[model samples]
Target: MDLLMKSLKIGVNEKLYIKDPESSTLGKNIVEQSILMIDEMGFDNFTFKKLGVKINSNESSIYRYFENKHKLLLYLATWYWGWVEYRMVFATNGISDPVKKLEKAVEILTQNVEEDSSISHVNEVVLNRLVINEYSKSYLVKEVNQENKDGYFVVYKRLVNRLSEMIAAVDGKYPYPISLASNVMEGALHQYFLKENFPTLTNCNDSITPTEFFTNLIFRTLNQNIHG
Candidate 1:
């Protein structure tokens, strides 16, 4: 499901009614605009007043949708993960073969990185910082818990599990491990993105698109590790 559809389902399950289409759109707009602002200003420097001006909506209107700036950030993060999940689902749909499915998953994720550079950059900077801050300080722990319960992690866990199943399908004796695959996938992409785009980092002319690099790397690594 797309982020909006997922959000609507959650709202319905929670007995909340959108009631007003304009209000619903406005709230979503606020969250999206807030993320963009957080991207440009960094989370620490972003403020409700600044977001208000950017969205052309008053602070009171924003507060009506979100209790506070922290809540807004949480919602934005949730929406982001929702969008990622949506893309993954779309990319994996109609693929039945395990190996093909796994390849497609890698392709989708890598292509997503290049397809939406702005959102990808925002996710790298703002959402990652928030996750790290929460992990380090243990603040917002409860909010993170709530977000997970709302199916954000559920979708990712399912994806990983499916990938693991595919690996097992390919090689009967293979040690199918979702966590290991996930770590490898994320680590490779993080290195690529940081080196290519992050300021103050050494630039490497890797020149390879994420899809090409990941497709070859993942297939080769899996084949060597599991089949060799």
Candidate 2:
């Protein structure tokens, strides 16, 4: 996503919020600075009290929007996926060929994020970093089944289903469309995670982007099996 890309705005799910953070300055600060802080310090060390002190607000004020840090993380993940879906929709608006559209969707899912001004409070770049590092925690929790039932995972499912449709369009009999779609998303992040901290574990080198790597990977796998 281009840091300078315009008009890519989206809203977080209401189920993820106790009160809409975008409605108030203090709430916005909680969402904005929390992303920055969590991305910097990692999620386990993050707290509303610390975020409150950083944002120059009270702990109680931050709690007014989020039940806990976990819910806030859920909010961030929900927002990120919704925003990604928006990007996919916008990027492939007029595309006809399923292969080309699927490739573009992979690019949207895997590309590096830059700062976006669509929202005044959150930085998409840092939020994407948090998603890369901390996304699994959002759903890899004990309450995940309950949260999934509550529709917290709808945006993510929508993104995968959208791409799976494109995959199915290209090859109606493709049996692994949904699994492949989810892999493209998760695998791209996994590659980025490996490259960022454990460079020796991956060949992500300085030339090819994770986006390009996964796009090529998916197309290659699909091409080999899509027609046969």
Candidate 3:
């Protein structure tokens, strides 16, 4: 898996970037530093100029890689979803049992992210936190309709569809596979956020994880849909 990941390039939408950040050192630095900065300062407070100062480059250089910080956020979100899709494919590969395959997919999607050493420039752990905390900012705007039309969110939608297919594989009769799959993905993020900020509102914590919660919820609903 490590060797495969090392060779793999998680592709983001070309329209999201002025220049691909993975193509050069400075561009990579901008991505790396910006992830950390956004994770630390939150997206509303983050700026390309601040990222440039941290990377010892002019703000204009950052713009060369991205039109604006919103685009950069979209780039990061797309890249992260692409990476998830790759892992989901790898983890479920050759698994014959539909239930087992769906179980593994849930685990991969909801499990706590550890830094993947295969990609040294971007930290998966911090990027995961950024996605959980700030990913909505990338799309929750008046321009979302246009951006969606422009394919800015193709990777994310594809990821959801992949999960939706896995759900359908497990339960052929399940009527709301897409909704369930999307809820698992988005709900895991909300559960994580609640676990951090409003512990009482969520049942997930160190002992009871969001992965376990969602896994249980999925199979239970499917079983009932099948039998009841």
In terms of TM-score, the best-performing candidate is: 3
lDDT of 2 by residue, 117-166 (tens): 45677788899999999999999999989999999899999998998888
Instruction: Report the C-alpha lDDT of model 1 over 154-198, residue by residue, as the tens digit.
Output: 544555665566566666565656765576445554645555467
lDDT of each: 0.55, 0.85, 0.91
RMSD (Å) per prediction: 6.0, 2.2, 1.0
Displacement of residue 109 (Cα, Å) in model 1 is 1.6
Model 3, runs deviating above 4 Å: none
- Whole-model lDDT, candidate 1? 0.55
TM-score of candidate 1 against the unseen true structure: 0.66
Rank list by lDDT:
3, 2, 1
lDDT of 3 by residue, 1-228 (tens): 878887788988899998999999998889899999999999999998899889999999898999999999999999889988899989999899999999999999998797664586888889999999998898899999999999998887887898899899988999999999989989999999999999999999889999999999999999999998
> Which is better, 1 or 3, measured by lDDT?
3
Each model's total of backbone clashes: 0, 0, 0
**Model 1: CA > 4 A from native:** 1-23, 112-152, 197-206
Q: Where is model 2 more than 4 Å wrong at Cα? A: 1-9, 115-118
